[model samples]
Target: MTLLAVQVLMWIVVGAAATGFASWLAHRSYRRFLRKSRGPVSKSLGRGDVPTKLDTLIDPLEAQFPCQSGLATLLDNADAFAARALSAAQAGRSLDLMYYIWRTDVTGWLLLDALVAAADRGVRVRLLLDDVNVQGFDPAFLALTQHPQIEVRLFNPTRNRGHVVRRTFEMLLGLARFNRRMHGKLWIADGRLAIIGGRNIADTYFATLDADTRNSVDADMLLVGPKVDAVAALFDSYWNLGLSMPILALWPGFKLNRTAFRHRLARHVGSAPSRHYLARTLDSRTPEAVLAGRLHWTDKVQLLADPPDKAYGNHSAAWMSTAIADILTNAQSEVRLITPYFVPGQAGISGLTALAARGVKISLLTNALAATDMLLVYGAYRRYRGALLAAGGSIHEFSPLPKNGRKRDMLHSKVFVIDGRQAIVGSLNFDLRSAFTNTELGLLFEHPTLVADITGMIDALSAPDQAYTVSRPDHALQWTVARPGLPKLMYVEPEASKLQRAISWLVGLLPIQAYL
Candidate 1:
């Protein structure tokens, strides 16, 4: 045979073999995943015991003052957002801040200053953070942990001896053990009030930028109400869990005088002041408060909450699945979800399709390609656009705001509003990562005002300047961002560049969905 013919035949054989192997691998993965889901896999968690020292903290925020209960205040941007946060910390008799990431940038330093000031005033303070995201940023926060009244705990920390061994351990264990992130971001003040939302202690979230907002898209909520108790309980669970450590022990040269601040906790009753804030927020005096308002659609508002004890069971991830089911079951008129990541896999796409079959209007708003921080997630998400679009589920992409406008606000809200009347805001996402990997929190409000607010926000976001409408044609996808030359951010099915598509395909083939 001629050499050219032989070479061509060899190439063909190799190509055919590789294609078959890939197909087999995909099938195997599908089978394995289904099996894992069906198996009785017990979750990893330790029981939560009540802290005997709870009485040492005063939380007037929980008092049944002249305010509505569950007075949830949704924050707009980080400038005013930070002010409220810092002031709350300063005013609190006792403060506890838990986070996944608290970088030592402009935002971090400012918050640290506020916490230190609070500590100086004899306020008892505690900070819990995940060590993985800290990288080299520990010293800045660790220094504060040394203060007498302050303590910091690292979550599932890595003993990175700065070697290849660290990489090996991470590879073998798959980091799934540590994939369980403290996605919870809350600030408990005086044990009575707390703020929960998508914002982390970072500059970008604060939105204080130059004329052009860069690295600046984010969202979060400042919560004040009885629900604070449930949130505080979750915090204490993590604090006392093995995954946490007292900040005092993690630092040196610490000097804290918690004596005077400890007394600030109103001992008039067995409950702590922080405890009072939660109760008050839930049962605030305002007749129009979130808790007091009559739900427009009471029966459909199913609250799938992930409390502290949930970590020991299926946790918040399980609750989120139930929430997803709720979205499917109740999305009669229309459904909208705004999540930072939009990596819905086969099951998610199938669920959306089922809803569409029933004539439900479905719309999704997520980061466009250039706007997304997690390209891999966008990649995986790219794979299913065609299927979803065909099923009647529409998609919209929130690009980073124009360079001349306010900083590109990252729509970090984990919100799901159904038929314009029921809504949920929590740490949960539409991806498997949120469903199985991270710790999350959220509340389902059945009030018309709350629902209207969300519906309006989604509607405004779906408009031109904010979000680009995503459409599918001939099973092909299209994106229309306001700025023409910025490169396409959203794709119909999975039409990102070749590199992105390949990256997503590879990740989709792996078991990384649990980690995002």
Candidate 2:
């Protein structure tokens, strides 16, 4: 080789070595900090015998159900938020909350204020959040810990707490560990009532986002019965896991002014929009309806959860996905699945084809390429779309446009209804990530009424105006848009531009399906 080429190659090798060494050093520093700042592990479990208003209200209902679980579906965004806020407001003993994302938006603040008010009323509050999204809110979290009645913990936190670049570097260095996140969403009030499902603590999930921004159509379940104990147990297992670290230990130096925080919360609560939203939420009277025994009661409720060890890459024990697969495998007649991201690998496709061979009908509703937020996941899903369609399965892709005067552009609920007799609802998306990578939780029940309710929701969302039907005929793919007076057909991904389709095609060539 020429002298100049040799010199340039040597410089490139040296630069790469330097970069690797720097990253290693940074990771080492983070490890040392974690060891030095580790706090005492939590010993608190879910309070079961606490005498609270929730118990007074729900005890009689439970007695009437008698070993059965009572569930109220929160299909409307406003009612979902209202159920949570009202539950928290009425908790007289303890409140436990776990989520993957808790935005600091209008609705987020309102719920936080509710929790704070509950704490002030002598209710013990425990907040467990995944560290992946709480990078910029350390100060507020730490301040929350200042309340004697409240505690804050982060699941699988990163060592770098300063900037996004540093956190990204840490994640890249420890990709395997960082990839296994806590995706379960649960809210337990006084260990007697709970809410579990796909909605997160954010304005978009609650449909309070601005018109220009897209909102999510999600689902959560208001649970009251013997099954709540299982939900609380799940929360305690995750809350007391070694992977959960207290926020105070992570950011000991950062502090927000307590009085200032209170003032800010009060100001927001007094705002006109907050007043209007809160009024609407209260007017829903969800908690009151639940106390009035207006819920689907059944004794066939089962809790599906991935063990806390799954976060440490242990998939040996029975997983929630396996249980769900078993339910699907035992389907007698029909199955309906609604998921935001549908990257069904070979195994999933094979399972569906097997069901189809048995003369069982299968219907699926997932995000269209234009509606999906993750383009890479969409690319992977497209690979299996044709196979699923050819296997005698009906597929409907959600449209991003407004539907039924509601500004819903994204489908975020994870639901499965089987045989028109049973249903599973929670945060388990039918994808590789949810199946093997992340921890998920859900409620499976054999109540025909609840199953029918979820089935109705699926039917409405898959309507022609709201979604496009995908079919594979004559050895080609087609999307049939049957909107009112706007019937159309397309061969490529509907509503997607040429550049977007090209990018999805390019992404499909990469071997990153496992991450999606």
The lDDT of model 1 is 0.59
lDDT of each: 0.59, 0.85
Top-lDDT structure, candidate number: 2
- Clashes, model 2: 0
Per residue, candidate 1 scores C-alpha lDDT tens digits across 239-303 of 76654544333333545444432332223122443234334332333322221232222222233
lDDT of 2 by residue, 248-268 (tens): 877667777899888878898
Question: Model 2: residues >4 Å from true position, as ranges?
Answer: 1-50, 284-286, 290-293, 403-408, 484-487
- What's the TM-score of each model vs. the native? 0.71, 0.92
